[model samples]
Target: MKDSSHPQATPPHPAEDVLDHLGYRLKRAHAALRGAMDQALREHGLTVPQYACLEVLAARPGLSNAELARATFVTRQSMNVVLRGLQDAGLLTRPATVEAGRARPASLTDEGRRRLNAAQGAVYAIEARMIETIPGERLSRLLEELDGMARALKD
Candidate 1:
């Protein structure tokens, strides 16, 4: 009963073609990016979380564990573990007790800055490679679209 002469008539997309899904593509891209960053950061003796913490601390100077967890899109417990490891490595410092509130603010040690500086080059290089894949004119639009997608899901 269907008109075969109609040009718009097409078969339904197969469910197995996950690559055609926007979420699947986004997830795949994120996984690839994470893997690349992890490999690059490993050479600097830093994990992704460690690098993120240091990067945030370097910019903000002092941030509570909860603040960091939110910023890094991780759980507070995971951030605490990362803080502990970084502290043990002498890359960051936080007082054992807080005077005003329960939150112990964290900051990077001098060594942390040095290490972050060393790692930045490799990280930037990786970013550059990613950016190179997209056209320069479309970069801003792509970023805005990505942000829009995130906001749409978040709300």
Candidate 2:
């Protein structure tokens, strides 16, 4: 038998209490963030995919539908629906006919830019609130750690 002089350090988030696995915690965090974004984006008249598409297009104009679908982590079929809705809403534009390749590229309209800029305030606020939960100095380290975790799972 070993001496019980030194006790184990309790984790900040104790195991099985929060389902304390890193992946499960990550999923939980993602779910919460998604829920918050969905509510905020709804007020801006955008679905999450539409907002994501607008954000991506604003940064990189004229991305093909296939490229967009990949960038947004959605299926091409789902992105087709998003593109159609955005087009119908006059938030984005695409050629009526395909360009060189099978997929037509997309660009945001003026209205799209206006809406995205408005929605960004809410989105950034939500992110800022999340960041406030951790120490300011840890913010960059947290981001790097999150990226590291993602890279570790890429295989």
Task: Please give the CA lDDT of all the candidate structures.
Answer: 0.91, 0.92
Clashes of 1: 0
Q: Which lDDT value does model 2 have at 12?
A: 56
Per-residue lDDT for 1-35 in model 1, tens only?
76768865343455556577667777898898899
Reference-based TM-score of each model: 0.88, 0.86
Off by over 4 Å in 2: 1-14
